[model samples]
Target: MQLFEHNPIKIYNSLSGKKETFTPIETGYVGMYVCGPTVYSNVHLGNVRTFMSFDMVFRYLKHLGYKVRYVRNITDAGHLENDADAGEDKITKKARLEQIEPMEVVQRYTVDFHNILNTFNFLPPSIEPTATGHIIEQIELISTIIENGFGYEVNGSVYFDVHKFNETHEYGKLSKRKLEDLIHNTRELDGQSDKRNPQDFALWKRAEPQHIMRWPSPWSDGFPGWHLECTAMSTKYLGEQFDIHGGGMDLKFPHHECEIAQNEAAKGKSPVNYWMHANMLELNGQRMSKSTGNTVNPDELLSGNNDFFSKAYAPSVIRFFIAQSSYRSVLDLTNDGLLASEKGFYRLMDAVNLLEKLEVSKASTININAWRQSCYDAMNDDFNSPILIANLFEAAKYINQIKEGKETISAEDLATLTNTMNIFVFDVLGLENVVKNDSGTDKLTGAVNVLIKLRQEARANKDFALSDKIRDELAEAGILLKDGKDGTTYSVN
Candidate 1:
């Protein structure tokens, strides 16, 4: 909760197109609404990466002692099948293939999404409002947009008047796209039977004869449009205006841009103070998306069973990997990167363990202030997590050296180290010792293996005394050992 002297806490605001100091709307409180997954299929690694990034922001705000009302919506309905309004509902398509009801598909994937996020140790949002849960609210929002003359109802379908919204407010403000460019590249579809412009999107889509999800609204029996849900849900939960609105960078173009227009049309003001976007996760330098045929499921990442991964990676390792990069930058996934991150991740957790066991000295030899300052300085610069992590690794190296009697720390500095790490690493960044279930047994096994390797290296280097000493030290650590044909075998006694 302590804001350090070096703390700046700058955030990249998409609205302003600049990194700005993150001051909350309400004093000491943050109202954040992030667009959740559509839940029409298992969440891809790309989606997981975005959520993890937001989790860091959410966790960090809470760590700052800010009262955060984080609202993430489950798009059980309202989201379109594609960016265009022409495609079928993704959930309905999934239901057809799975031979189940659309709601059944929603429930299954929604549960799956939660399971994967929980495995990653992400805290649940303050409120998770489903679009299906707020049909009336969405209907009311569409009505307001229509009443404001920014939308029109055609037959049973209601579409937002984008050409009209652009007259008063910059429609492409969020995406930095020009209206003329959109009109030029825009593919004219058949759905615009009554739309005022080709660039306009739906607020409510009239249900087709075979449509699975439908609700009776003032306009007609239909479902809400994809962007309408967020506009409705955020206003309903976080009020008409909120602190931050975030989602994947891909959503910035049409989805978020449309949401901005819808909110402004209904409320006469922008819904969010700041627009935050986390970049996509790429595989082999290509975006990992369903359309790209390179999507990696969270289950694959957790089990490490995907063709892209050699071994299973823990959820914390995944979180750390994403956090090591700026939220606004695309994160490339590589086998070597994960391997390097695995080592870095364990090294970090190892430092946390060392801090808990360190015996504080009366006087310090290490400069703890410099380390603390560097951490704050990095985090303050637009949540530069990679720099913060590098600083943390430096502290870890110092902690390890101190543990080995090669360095020293004062009692006060030791307490600072403990608290600093607990705040930034665990609380703010939201990394957990996910290996705790196997930590006790795993630690002993790992130590024994390391000692055996060291002893073999010593023997190879013709250091008999060092090899003997290594074996003796491990024995004291409750690991009895026997010389083996292969090398040495160890067992905990």
Candidate 2:
């Protein structure tokens, strides 16, 4: 039986504004599309949260035996400053400032984005299509919209007629805004804009003579609009309608709303089955914004080089911190929260390691089947990772009891426990054993051992200050030294 049939999965659908049961277009298969980074600058922590949430969703779907074709597009072109479809393209602006070609900026930041996501252990999407690569597809989509009478060409640029489309279909169903409200609330662009209505977004922008990124379109020598690439790329990879379309909650208004209008205008039906949105992440109770200097980069957090964190944190700790909360809720990044999660993560992993050393008895004390089912129950209820983690902690308590001989488990129950923990912790959660066994770890161990010997000699020689100095310095560097009956053992905290 398919996993969802046995253990049904529910997802919070932003389109419907409810938690709906996930039913794929085809049985036993899923096609998911998520918006990727624009590759103009370093990705912030908020972007990481959105991507990680989808990564968990992707991993869980695969774990449930679904064949998932996940497509996340790279916005290397057509993404503009302010997302207003008026300013210069982000990649082009960055290139002008750096005195290099636009492709260089895209290449540099795209590599950085991949490296950061790799550090967080994110599973790469199945198809990573780029906006620049699908220009022909975008042009075709624009042409179809025009031929369908929902788009118009003014001068050299093309704009989607939001007023015209809304006459037949609801334009703001996904965002839950009426056309009247949108028209009143829409901000007027400065100077003479080509759009008939401020709410009508660009389908194909006419490139200025000095614009660096320009292509040959039927309307003009121009580039695709900010919102056109996703519709084209998603329809190209997945069909006109797919299982899931996801992005950060901030994209819900103009970007995703425009996408819906474009697709519905060209095609007769809505393009996505379920619209999933990951909530924003905040820093110290305020929204993260780079302009206000209230943002933290992934590299800074991992390297502990920023003023926000007390010490360096492993990438796994950050990932575990994110998993502690639901993706639909706003997560505040605080030092205390991260430190607490760090302790919890280590405790969980320590129990998993101890499971192998646990001794089995003749009879089991706990119902292994019930505990296993609860894990699935938590995941099935809209991917409630926080609840799943609570269940994992309960399993950890049981593991500890088994280790202490306070509880007993039969061989079969023990095997189930082992598999359950492995699947949930490693495969589904995407967490790693951050403890390294490579040569660098060995080298560090050797150096620390030399220091331990020096400290021992200092103590023997009654050099109290030297021994205390070594201990205090190591502690400050996030290395905990445990002085046991068998000498000293050090661990990175």
Candidate 3:
């Protein structure tokens, strides 16, 4: 039997706003599409967080024995500077400024995107289709929408008739905003614009005389609109209706909403059974903004060359930090958080390294099966990684106790525990083991011993201020110190 049959998964549906038991369209198979980046610049850290969240989901589903075809598309063309269908194509604008071809810019940043993802140990999607490669499919999709009377042509450009579609169908259901509200909020369009309504979005835009990218279509020698490529490519690869559609939470309003409308406009049905959106990432405590200097790119974060972090962090530490929170919650990237995660990651790996050396006893003191089930239960509840991490720490504690000779485990239970930990840590969570000559505990003990000595000297000199500072700072870094009859000791959190 498939592993999914043994441990069912419940995914939080962005469309439904509730956790629903995940049922794939076909048995033992899942089709998932995530809206990928527009390759105009280096990939942002927020983008990395979003994709990393889904990477965990993809890894877990495969571990559950589901044959998953994951499609994440690249927007090499048609994404405009302003997402509302006005302004120059972002890639084209970048090419113009850099004095190069648009495809050159796409090539440069696409490789950068891939490199960063590789650094973070992300699994490449099953199909990484590009917008420029799917122009014909987009044209055909637009033709179908036009034939179905939901699209209109003006001059050489085409726009989806949102008012007409909303008459028979709910236009804002996915985003939960009423059509009337959008109409009220939108500014009045001048006579210069072609759209019949302000809420209408472009399906294709006519190429200007100096436009860098253009494709021949029934409407015009132009590029497809930003929203059309996803509809064309996702349906082409996954089908009219697939298992899941995912992206960052920011895409909910017009990007994903437009995809929904375009799919229903062409195929007369919702394109996905489950919709998932990973929450945004913040730097420090505030929202990451480039203008405000609160932003850090993936390269700067890993290299520690930016103003944010004190030292460079390994990819696995960052991955572990991201996994410590639910994908649905906003993740804050702070230096303290990363340091704590680095400690926790190494501690977990230290326990894993000790598993083989652990001596088996006559009886298992811990209930191995129950602990295993709790790990599965956390992941089953909407891919709750934080709870799963907590459970993994519990297992790590058990391993430490066994090493201290305070606990016992049978040979069978030891094997089971090792297999489960390996599968969840390396396979499912996509974390790489950081092999050290000396384990994390050994290093932490050395450092804490030095600090404990300094603190003892400070207390003996009646300098309580310095002693408290050392102790409190360690606590902030997720370490605890204790003084007992046997002098002082410390624990790595």
Candidate 4:
């Protein structure tokens, strides 16, 4: 485990409704399940925020030497317009509109989904299960719920008995809502002539003729419900009892709450130890949603077609922009905010490049150990990434000072600082500078060399004013330079 000196990581557990110290179920193994995207369309920025937060957690746990089996499921089927019970699956709807096979929709967007996540530098999960791959497991789970008297089948459709589950198992415990509120707030469920209560959600839905994504099951030619996919796939991969379950806060009620009842009904025990929810991403103080027409698709942003962005942003900058804020808070997207984040990101990258090149002193002037501790402290406290970033920025400033001959570092301290920055920023946070595929050209190399030489001559002549002006001007042209004790090195921004 390469954890820092002060790695007492605390995280806000939605299960306990408070921040608690994180300890995996097993001594050195962690089982984490995160709800993944429903492959109906392109994933928006709001959806990516949740994954980014979990990436931080997953990376940190791995960095701490925990053998973590991270599972994030893809909903290839069963997610519907009005929850799982109301009617048509979302993917099916898209297929109908596009006049394509349902699997075509699944394959296209699933590929697109992976591309976007990779662009943002998200590590692929240990197990990326699709709902369509585990139909038998979902059927077995529905059967168990029925045998345990918490689910009922009518007209070949199975619905969980939420009201009855509430009587014995506290159905609303996860969401902190009274059963009465749910009943009142829930409008009369559609296609619910078979359900015993309005709050009872489907565990298995009997597919109609137009529904093309169903599997043949004991119940009928049907598909698993939206919540059933997560419950079945996670338990099958991670186990009936696991450490953590995470998703967007919008899934708190009905989605996650129903999942709890389904798992308890089948397993006769709580499925997860900790519940974590990342808040939604907001746009102009309003939620960015598909229906609201304010969603920013990653592909659109990458192509510079998003109305909110005037120019295309590199993937690393977009990743950092989301990570700069705490996961639990809503990150409101603004052009000014993103521009500021771009500058900070480049500054951080510049310092990172300068760290190893720094000259070592006999004794330390800046406290690298304290800075390292602060980085761990921020992460340990519920994976507070913004604070971790702030600490990294402080470390970056010191690195810049040492590069500029303003501070000094011991040889031992230099190694520690390098290791700390690499672990926290690159491995744990999963941020990186873009690596462009450029064939080395004589013209390009000559131009860059000429600029560096000119800067060198300016510095040798005690022309501090000229040196700063050249640096600033070249920076605006997307060339960043670091003036080291020995010489200056540069990288294209």
Highest lDDT: give the candidate number.
3
> How does candidate 4 score on lDDT?
0.84
Q: Write model 1 residue lDDT over 94-133, tens digit each, in one string.
A: 8899999999999999999999989888899999999999
Q: What TM-score would every model get versus the actual structure?
A: 0.88, 0.91, 0.88, 0.91
Give the lDDT of residue 260 in candidate 1.
Answer: 87
The backbone clash count of each candidate, in order, is 1, 0, 0, 4
Of candidate 2, the 10-residue stretch with the lowest lDDT total is 433-442
Q: After superposing candidate 2, which stretches have Cα over 4 Å from the reference?
A: 82-87, 436-492
Can you list the residue pairs that collide in candidate 1?
A: 9-380
> Per-candidate RMSD vs. true structure?
5.2, 3.9, 6.0, 3.4
Q: Which lDDT value does model 4 have at 170?
A: 88
Worst 10 residues of 1 by lDDT: 433-442
Q: Which segments of model 1 are wrong by more than 4 Å?
A: 1-8, 82-87, 434-493
Tens-digit lDDT track of model 4 for 401-449: 8877788899999999999999988998898855321224656656766
- 251: Cα error in model 3, Å: 0.4
Per-residue lDDT of model 3, residues 267-325, tens digit only: 99999999999998988889999899999889888898999899999999999999999
Best by TM-score: 4
Model 4 CA deviation exceeding 4 Å by range: 1-6, 83-86, 435-447, 454-491
